[model samples]
Target: MEFRVLGAVEATADGAPVDLGSRKQRLVLAVLLLDAGRPVSRDRLVDLLWPADPPASARGTVQALVSRIRAVFRAAGGPELVTEGPGY
Candidate 1:
C-alpha cells in the first residue's frame, strides 16, 4: 500500500482504492503516519485516542485499534504497518 497523508488519509493498493472508515480508525492511522513509521508506544496511543479519562480496557482498545489499522494496510497489499518494541 502506498499512502499519502496530508490533510486527510488516502491509501491505494496496486492502483486500487482502500477504505478505512470510522473516526477512531482514522485517528489511529493519522497518528502513526505523523510519526513517520516510528513505533508509537501503546501508552501514548491510549492517551492520544482517549484523552481526559480512558476506559479500564484502554490498552486493549488501543491494541485492537492498531490491529484494525494494520488489517486495512494488509488489505491494501502492504506489509504490517506497525511495529512494537520497548519504546518508540
Candidate 2:
C-alpha cells in the first residue's frame, strides 16, 4: 500500500485507489502518514483538528476517525496501524 499526501490525501493498494472517506478523515490519515513510525498522541491529533476550540468530545471523535482509517487500511491489505498510548 502507498499513500499520496502531496496534493490530495490518497492511498493505493496494488495499483487500486483506496477511498479515504471525508475531508476530516483524510486529514487524520495524512497526519498519521506524515508522522509514520512515530507515536502521535491523541491530544496532538485533537489539537491539530480543532486548534481554536475543541469540543468536549474531541478526543473521542479523533479516536473514531482513526478507527475508520484503520479499517480502510485493513481493507487495503495494510498491516495494523495507528496504535494508541498516553500523553500529558
Candidate 3:
C-alpha cells in the first residue's frame, strides 16, 4: 500500500485508490503517517483532533476512530495498524 500526503491525503492499494472515510478520519491518518514509525500518544491525538475544545469523551472518540481506520485498512489488505502502549 502507498500513501500520499502531499495533496489531499490519499491511499492506494494495488494501484487502486482507497477510500479513507471522513475528514476527521483523514486527519487521523495524516497524523499517524506524519509520525510514521513513531507512536503518537492519545493525549496528543486529542489535541490534534480537537484543537479548540476537546469533549469529555475525546479519548474514546479517538479510539473509535482508530478502530474504524484499522478496519478499513485491514479490509483493503493494506498496512497493519499497530497499537503500542497508550498510542496507536
Q: Least lDDT summed over 10 consecutive residues: which range in candidate 3?
A: 71-80
lDDT for every model? Answer: 0.76, 0.84, 0.92
TM-score of each: 0.81, 0.91, 0.95
Off by over 4 Å in 3: none
Q: Candidate 2: minimum summed lDDT over ten consecutive residues — where? A: 79-88
Q: Per lDDT, what order, best first? A: 3, 2, 1
Q: Give candidate 1 misplaced runs (Cα > 4 Å).
A: 86-88
Clashes in candidate 2: how many? 0
Steric clash pairs (candidate 1): none
lDDT of 3: 0.92
Better of 1 and 3 by lDDT: 3
Question: What CA root-mean-square deviation does each model show from the true structure?
Answer: 2.0, 2.0, 0.8
Residue-wise C-alpha lDDT for candidate 1, range 1-88, written one tens digit per residue? 7777787787788888788777777887878878876788888878888899999998887777778887787667776664658323
Residues 15-70, model 2: lDDT tens digits: 99999899989988888788888888888989999999999999989888988888
Arranged by TM-score with the best first, the candidates are 3, 2, 1
How many angstroms is residue 80 displaced in model 1 relative to the true structure, after the best TM-score fit? 2.0
